[model samples]
Target: MTDKTVLTERNGRIATLRLNRPAAMNALTADMLSLLGDELEAIAGDKGISVVVLTGEGRAFTAGVDLKALRDSGQDLTEGNVGDALNGAARWVQQLIERMPQCVIAKVNGFCFTGGVELMLACDIIIAAEEAKFGDTHAMIGLRPTWGMTQRLGRKVGMQRARELSFTARTITGVEAAAYGLAMEAVPLAQLDSRVDELAQAIAKNSPGSIAAYKDLYRKSENAGLDAGLAYEYETKYEIADVRERMAEILKRLGG
Candidate 1:
């Protein structure tokens, strides 16, 4: 685990990234962040890979940032040191996940706390297992969030619920996460990989050109008002060349 804090695998058009520090419950270290950032950078440039699934190697998705690592590095959550310790490389990894050309899914197999939750939220989609725990324990640890937790959490689960979770520092089951809008769905642990694969395969089979366009359009729309988003959608040039071929293939099954 020291040598490989993150592992990568590719199957056709889908890539899977697994956090490899099971003994530490896949805790986040600066080294792990560097490795993950490198992996994501490579994946982002791959036109053949359209989907990525991120999960843990063992029981916990992650117990959040490696506090021991931070302490050993002579950093702590004292006053303003929290953000300083986590910014640079760590922040880059979060941005990489958000801006990647391909869709990223967080497969929460087990305990997900604080920074782990932040990392999980960075993914475009979240499919959690029913037994997994989702918690924002920053308050309990006396450390403020340096990751996008303050911003992204509210967006995912609405501001009020987000406030409650962060304020209370409580944990929730994956089923509750879906109902609260943090996860797309919560399924049995045994079905998590299969379900993710099912969706990943379905998405991978679609036209890559259109997929790229959709990703670009969706990313752009996130910051724009509705009218502006719609205007862009209507006026911008859509250069996908396989629409006719796709339509023809679909129409062949229409009994027309």
Candidate 2:
């Protein structure tokens, strides 16, 4: 088997990104993050692709940062080089998921912990299998989540729950994760693939421009205060107003 950190493939309108380091449980490295960013950027400009799904090969989605790589770096986590190498992947992948036009989905199975959990939170939709486990074990390992975990987790599952999860660094089952709103849905391991395909196909059938706008709306709303969100909605509505006008003109020309 290949040992690349990342792999990509286009399946008709759906692009699949697989984390391929299964021997290490797909623990992320800096190169993987850069590759994923490059892939997302490429897909953004490819009209043939309409949606993107992120998953991992073998038993785990990802085991977070590569512990062995950290040891090999011979640099303290507090230092610039090793920390940058370790965390940069998470940063770039998170940013790519946020800015990409395609509908991003996390098809998670097995261990989705620490950075894996943070990365999934970046996705627009997360669908996990029954056997998957989600957690933030950073604190347990004498580290803290420096990603957007503190901000996004609470918005996902509420402040109280986020505090409990991050502070305790406990593992939550896929079903419990679904209940906490961490996942969009949880399916049996056997049916997970079909469910992801069904959802991806449904998303791919929608207007690409409309889907992009919808995803942006969530991001803006998530970061905005009530008043600011309302203002953003108005601005977005004004922007889309032109699309409606053009649509009407097209229908008129067709004598519909």
Give the clashing residue pairs of candidate 1, or none.
Answer: none
Worst ten in a row by lDDT for model 2: 237-246
Residue 181 Cα positional deviation in candidate 1, in Å, after optimal superposition? 0.8
Off by over 4 Å in 2: 78-82, 237-256
What tens-digit string does per-residue lDDT give for candidate 1 at 1-256? Answer: 2558899999999999999999999999877888899999999999889999999998999888887887788764576345554666678888898888788989999999998999998888899999999999989988888787888899889999999999999999999999999999999999999999999999899987787677767866876889999988788886777888998989999964
Question: What does the lDDT come to for candidate 2?
Answer: 0.85
Query: What tens digits encode model 2's per-residue C-alpha lDDT throughout 86-201?
Result: 57767877988987878999999888888888889999999999889998888877776767888899988999999999899999988998999999899999999999999999
- In TM-score terms, candidate 2 sits at 0.90
Instruction: Return the TM-score for candidate 1, rounded to 2 decimals.
Output: 0.92
